[model samples]
Target: MDARRDVFQAIADPTRRAIIGMIAQKPVNVNTIAEQFDVSRQAISLHLKILAECGLLNIKQLGRERLCEAKLEKLNEVHEWVAQYHKLWTGRLHALKNFVEQEALQPRQANTDNKKKTKNIHKPKK
Candidate 1:
């Protein structure tokens, strides 16, 4: 219900996406995540905050360290939205393949018909 952050907008950044990928494998410390990027720790922290706001991440206080963990179920929103278009694109691409294949076969069939006509015309009348 937090309109301030949206999952899609949270994931739209390359750095944020990389951070998500890293943590999705396993929980990682905020410092460790910051080390992987050229950006400032503050910048990375902002990205982490946005991710947390959108429910895509869960930040844990592990003693003195903050750990970022992936709550990847949130990604199901993206997956479901994309799946709707996946079916449409799959059907369209299949239809395109069928059309191209049929067009390719058409020329070969025409050539065969031409060859039959030429053969008939060249045949010596008995």
Candidate 2:
């Protein structure tokens, strides 16, 4: 898979997202991360590998332990892409606001226009 695709796929999983969220709080070892999940250590390792490959996680070895930290800067790709639409959305929202204000200024019909008086209808002899 492409690098961007791998990153997108890695983040698509809720467990992986939670792992990233946790690491964003602080750098932690493999075992610490594994403990947070119900899956096996090996499974967590695989998820970490995918995250690292996507540049969303940074792994460094300190003595015998590998510390995984979130590399959230890579999210700029997504941020930049979404920002392009932000301007367009802003314009559309402004237009919608103007439209709503204009509509609200229109005159409203009286409620009695919708109500029928019993005297207006023909009545059967009792």
Candidate 3:
């Protein structure tokens, strides 16, 4: 059985992420995609291959040239995963805000207590 590549694994490399961003704007030929980066065509090709394996891109051959097109729908998996944490963190933050606001609304009992203690301290050592 063939193992499927994870989309997150494919995008883990900065080069691969950049390639995805570039192709997402429009379908680009391999040569054009390679030219944008400082890396060799071979390295870029490897990145493209990984992205293709992850289902993040579709490569179509046209005569001698291969055009790479972005298949961004695969990213929905990543989005869904992140959205879950986003909700959790947002709820936690909201709860924290409410707690802080409630604390602020209460009277300055600690300050009053400190003042009472200070009054006793000023009265000479009985």
Clashes of each: 0, 0, 0
lDDT of 3 by residue, 1-126 (tens): 127678888878999999999989899999999999999989998889889989999999999999999999999999999999999999999999999988886658777888999999899885
Worst 10 residues of 2 by lDDT: 107-116
Estimated TM-score per prediction? 0.85, 0.73, 0.82
lDDT-wise, the better of 1 and 2 is: 1
* Candidate 2 TM-score, C-alpha based: 0.73
lDDT of 3 at 82: 94
For candidate 1, the lDDT comes to: 0.93
Q: Please report, in order, the local distance difference test score of every candidate based on alpha carbons.
A: 0.93, 0.83, 0.90
**For residues 1-126, what per-residue lDDT tens digits would candidate 2 score against the true structure?**
354555667778998898998999889998899999999999899889888888899889999999998899877876787798998899999999999887776533333443444545655667
- Which 10 residues in a row give candidate 3 its minimum summed lDDT? 1-10
lDDT: which is higher, 2 or 3?
3
Q: After superposition, how far is residue 94 of candidate 3 from its true place, in Å?
A: 0.4
How many clashes would you count in candidate 3?
A: 0
What are the RMSD figures for all models against the true structure?
2.3, 6.3, 3.5
In lDDT terms, how accurate is model 3? 0.90
Instruction: Provide the lowest-lDDT 10-residue window in model 1.
Output: 1-10
Clashing pairs in 2: none
